[model samples]
Target: MSHALGIAWDMWSVGKVAAVLLVTFILSQLLLSWLHAVRAKRIDRKVAQLCEQSPKHECQSNPPESLPVTLITGFLGSGKTCLVNRILAGDHGQRILVIENELGAISIDHELIDEQAQKNAPSGVIVLKNGCMCCTGESPGSELERVLDKLLDFSQGDSASLVFDRIVIETTGMADPSPIIQVLLRSEMNGARFRLDGVVTVVDAKNLMRHISPQGPAGFLRHRPEAEKQIAMADLLLINKVDLVDSAAMVALTCALGQLNAAAKQLRASHAAVPWKYVFEPELDAVGLAQRRQAALSSDGAAHGPRVSCVTLTAADDVPLDALQAWLQRLVQERHEDLYRIKGSLAIAGEARKFVVHGIHADIQGTLGGEWGGEPRSSVLVLIGHKLPAERLEKEFARLSGSGRSND
Candidate 1:
């Protein structure tokens, strides 16, 4: 009788265990089913919403068309801010949102610009503080989704009609654009909430040579990989600061750029002044986007091969016209290799109009800009190069301008 009792107890325990397992499986299945149903409904709702916004078309079971996203990338000090500012200040007839990623502890780039312009601007700015979007050894999907949710909510909520026309992401100078591109591609796969329109890269025409040239042993480690990746991934390349480089230099740079990224469409500009339509509304075909994606993916990690620096000088007084011209000519001739770029607004004696000057290597140009503004006329020049004699250049400028004083 004791043996019989033991067998019955064992059977009871097994039955209880089986019951618990069955219940748990059922609960898990139910949860998964509910989640799948929720996802389906959400996708359906998005599809309906997209149909409402767009022209009447046959709706397949696929996800809706996503918000267009334009990525703007470049190396450090490559006029990215100027390009973004132009987009914000433009009259594109549609609202835009900008995602700004910075590499420093604090986001001072936004504060340095004019607040009023931003306040009145068409684009609403969002900043990702402290870290770069690409280099943190983490996927950008979660971070991007977190910020993009705001735009999604605005569009999908009660105000469905008020949707942002497009989104722009301005990456940090040190950022690798491949990871960022992958993030958007993933988002599209999950649901077409965001579609990559194109990548617009700003190349500093004056400093590009320095960034691309081969570095020696001492400087090899100092090269920038991000710069090369940026060029490789660009669908639209803006060779900015064109005024700084002469025609021959421009031709040579263009040829080199084609070698770097043959797929990208190139545009030349000064002060990032390309038309908003060209940068924002590029003629992007499916093949073009795919090619650009492949180009980015194919590049194994490579560092930027050049070392460059920037030097800025200011003159508070007016300079003689002939002296200014001769000084700039001589400076270009002497420091052509070391001098990558020079741009400035000069206050010249006996001249009603200000001289807008740009210099690249041995090429120098000075054009008469409009009249001076309300403030006193002065000369402000920014020079970029591999190695520059900052103090000597400042003193020479002072001597030429007859100011006896210059600030950097």
Candidate 2:
């Protein structure tokens, strides 16, 4: 009887220990759950506060005192560089920072333009070494984010601590302007500092018709031609070299452009000669920047058809905190044929440095970037490809960034 009593006591002790362990585990899980909830709320509060402080009183709009950025894009030999130089040479009296992206193996536009300016150029001009800023990174540290970081540093280092009054970006002839525009519009850091003033497209009047129609004698029908896309996105269309085309041809071309983009202001000029003020301060739609952001996010590249589309994803927290690498690897392996270009920045978890991600076709990269200064660690990702699974990709990014659905 005594032996049976001892065994019962031993069983009771074991049950007591098991109960203690189970209670501890439950309590620990609850604690973790509470912490994650708190962190999420904090992030939401920060975003809300920022929105409240914004001049547009919306989370997605630019600050009232943000710098203005002018984007110049066009076809090859369409006088994009020439237009940029003209703006630089003009007596705008505002300090300007120019970002130049080249397409060839060697960059010569910056030097050529500087030489042509003959001391009338802007305060500083930075030439990007990548072949094309729209889609040039094989790893992280996207060309766009790197350029923005540099701009921030430069603006801070200036003696007056005064950022340039104006910033101009000249894209290569063969680039898609949509990604560049998205970067300026969606990037939290960029929107806080620089507002998109206008998009000026320099059209080679001689070749404009040839590009607009694939059946023209030149027959330039690529899968995704940049010329038509450039025209489609232009706020101001400069039909350059009008002398090459007769008045009747000019009228016809203008009509054709109107059909493609009725909203854009069409102008004719010889040698890209247009008043700088027109390019810099065109009458933009009166909607606040937040409304503009909504329009941009909803309608970006919508008319490009199903064969090619651009998917942009945004996140409020840092990525790679979870399985970012595994997810990206799966993306590249599964979608190499459809993936064309990828670029953006990430706010790393528990780190001061920002992570930049870039991919061109199958080549993908992610690299550490500079620290975020007084700005929330919001992340942005832009993808240009054919038939992308945007929903799945967005979900994965949201999971990585710790935002439940989407950032913005």
Candidate 3:
């Protein structure tokens, strides 16, 4: 009877211990769940606060170590290739990688890159002749991004020490740089690995007046819209073939360019002869850009003229991706001819990364940009088109993102 009693006590003790362990585990799991909820709330609050902040607010500065890139864009017959040759033949000591983006079967520029630049890029120049860098390919991201992905993989390159310190991209004559800039800005891979230093647009001075407007007797032909777009987006404008144009024509062309983009500094030269300093110049800091914007506001000339206009739309909340896509598609389809380009960093519901979107006329495409990281998770979009309904677009985007205000 005594042995039986001892066994009963032992069993009771074991039951008590088991109960304690179960209760501890349950409590721990509950604590973890609570902590996660709290963390999520904190992140949401941060996003809300940042959304209310200024657009010029700098979230995080680019680290000093990432390779810097200079993008060259221009209309056909502009000395863009000449400028690339100058860069390739430059005496700059840094190792460089040149990306020649063309739509043709053969890349003449790739062959035109002299042996000196090849010495800088021991792996040789990369040619992405499939299509324009901004246009959508079979993949979600731009073809340029795909090329960037491979080059940025430092471990997979030929040698650690021979890694390129700088990159120069020579885009096709008809290229629009806005989408390319959007890609660079949105890609976290680029964010971590490369810095898009700035865009330098080379203009054809000899053909400027002829392309700016219809000069023929009938006046049926329209102006070269791409020329103005290219000029407007540039941080620096290099007017090439200046020797071919008279002083009065040069002055007129310069004035037109300034009116299109009051922000960019202009230089005149023959054969794309620009200094190495301007070729690889960094973009203006936030303060400088703000000042430039102010200057543009105070200018006397009509900005962008009547042929083309650019509008910005911004909002604070996230929306369903499919609904947003459907709405945008219908809008783009209806206004395909009028809308030249559409690009945005969008906030999608339940998504961890920002949805970066690019549209050329009717062809709208999007892909996962990157995690929010340290930046504010607000939606900002740029629409470049002919006579855009800015106020209407602002209101629509505002309503879509649950914001009462519009940045337009």
Q: Write the per-residue lDDT of candidate 3 for residues 197-291, one digit (tens) a residue.
A: 77898989888656665466754365677787787567788989999987777667776665455446677889887777877774333223223
User: What is candidate 2's CA lDDT for residue 113?
Assistant: 44
In terms of lDDT, model 3 sits at: 0.62
**Candidate number with the higher TM-score (1 or 2):** 2
Per-residue lDDT, model 3, residue 275, is 71
Residue-level error in angstroms, candidate 3, position 205: 1.0
Q: State model 1's lDDT.
A: 0.62
Model 2 Cα shift for residue 340 (angstroms): 16
Model 2 per-residue lDDT tens digits across residues 1-408: 999999999999999999999999999999999987875565444333333333453555433677788888898899988876666555666666666665332234553343433343224433222211111112123345434444444444332243357777777788877655655544343335556677888899998665556454445454336776777667788889999988777666765655444435667889888877778876533122123234444442313334445555776656664477787888889996676556556677777977766555566667677778776667766665667777887787777767734312
Quick one: best TM-score, which candidate? 3
**Candidate 3 off by > 4 Å:** 1-64, 102-161, 187-191, 217-222, 285-305, 310-408
For residues 46-162, write the lDDT of model 1, one tens digit per residue. 444533444333666644566788989999888997887666655656566666665332233554344544443233333222211111112233333333443344455433443
Query: What is the lDDT of every predicted structure here?
Result: 0.62, 0.61, 0.62
Clashes of each: 2, 6, 0
